[model samples]
Target: QSYIFYGPTMSPFTAYLIIRGISTLEIRIRQQEKNALKVAQFLENHPKVERVYFPGLDSHPQRDLVKKQMHGTGSVLSFVIKGGYAAGETMVNNVELVTLAVSLGCVESLIEHPASMTHSELSPEERKKSGINDSLIRLSVGLEDAEDIIDDLKRAFEKV
Candidate 1:
């Protein structure tokens, strides 16, 4: 026997549910964007960070395009650690306030080493070709206080 599957369609109830959160979601997302930019700036200046990739930063190659297309930069940012995978692991493992997790867009802050965690199955060459180096770390800034988050990163860097 063969089976076919169909996804649920958007009904009035679903639309109502989505509309209910729009206003609050918009406010929280704007705050997250601001916090993310601040964190990115801090990481860019840190000695342990080799580079940061966030469109909100002037260093991003597509910053001009980001300014044209979006009112605010999104909350996600990635950076390369100076000491490679081992340092990335130490930082993620040591973070107390920022949860070490693979997912994104949560209410609490999260940090992860994409090379050793998310993309571990791939070989080093494959990961390198994909622009995911052994030292690369991905962060999803959430609704947490910006200073607290930055402090969490600073503490974690001490471990590295």
Candidate 2:
């Protein structure tokens, strides 16, 4: 019973194209999740990584629950650095491919430190309780080839 109430400027072909792309969002997410799990696995074994946290990892505390309830891992994951806050900052600044930015769920990868970026305004005690530590680096994997993504990350570690 829903009617298509588009403007005269909107061509039927263009409208249908937009609708088709929107409808594939779920499919796109599944593919991205699969790609992300592969990247997470690579990072986990990398010598520079102190810890990798992805819901797909069996070592992750919520892995089973996430697998049961979620269709995908949602493309974003966080990890802690061995040297803590300073090391995280070094990696963020040294990375060439991945951008440093807030927000997620995009077609391009992004990295950010919540304690100094998004949650910078929070009080020290609030940040601690929330587990948004200065040493944490959050990555939102994108459509790029996973090898290239991991290579860029490894390059960043060289500078850190």
Candidate 3:
């Protein structure tokens, strides 16, 4: 004798969900890449940005190594504020569109105080040795229109 069980198969629904998520992820990732490149180019020469650390910039110190080791420059880059911590914190707070938050790899732009957020877990000496400081601001570029994002940054810098 043999026994047969009947139930709704979940494979089709699961496949659809997987495919849908992948498609959305691909689109957002492409947009984010384009946006990041544009923003990096903009900030590279901006007066307030002492240095833009995005690999896409030919002037970036590690551009050569980046070309050989990385698939993309990614959305995040750290820049030093002109006047140090006071100016950096002011810039972070003045931004309207960019959210002051931790983490990266999101569709929405985020700014974080690594010295107090990601590096806060480390002691002052450790943070200093690791090159994380109050004067540095890390930006996670988002999928927003490049011009609007730049405009927001310009406005924020003006306030800073």
How many clashes show up per model?
A: 0, 0, 0
- What digit string (tens of lDDT, one per residue) describes model 2 on residues 1-160? 7989675687899999989989987877777777788878987887768889899888889888988998667889888776766788898888778889988778788888887788889976898899877778899988777778888888998888
Candidate 1, residues 102-155, lDDT tens digits: the string is 998887789999887999999989999998889999999999999999999999
lDDT of each: 0.92, 0.83, 0.83
Give the distance in Å from residue 1's predicted Cα in candidate 3 to where it truly belongs: 23
Error of 2 at 51 (Å): 2.2
lDDT of residue 152 for candidate 1: 92
Predicted candidate 3 versus true structure: per-residue lDDT over 110-145, tens digit per residue: 887676677778887887898877678899999888
Question: Ten consecutive residues with minimal summed lDDT in candidate 3?
Answer: 112-121
Higher lDDT: candidate 1 or 3? 1
Estimate the Cα RMSD of every predicted model relative to the unseen true structure.
Answer: 3.5, 4.2, 4.5
- Best model per lDDT: 1
Report the poorest 10 consecutive residues by lDDT, candidate 1: 2-11
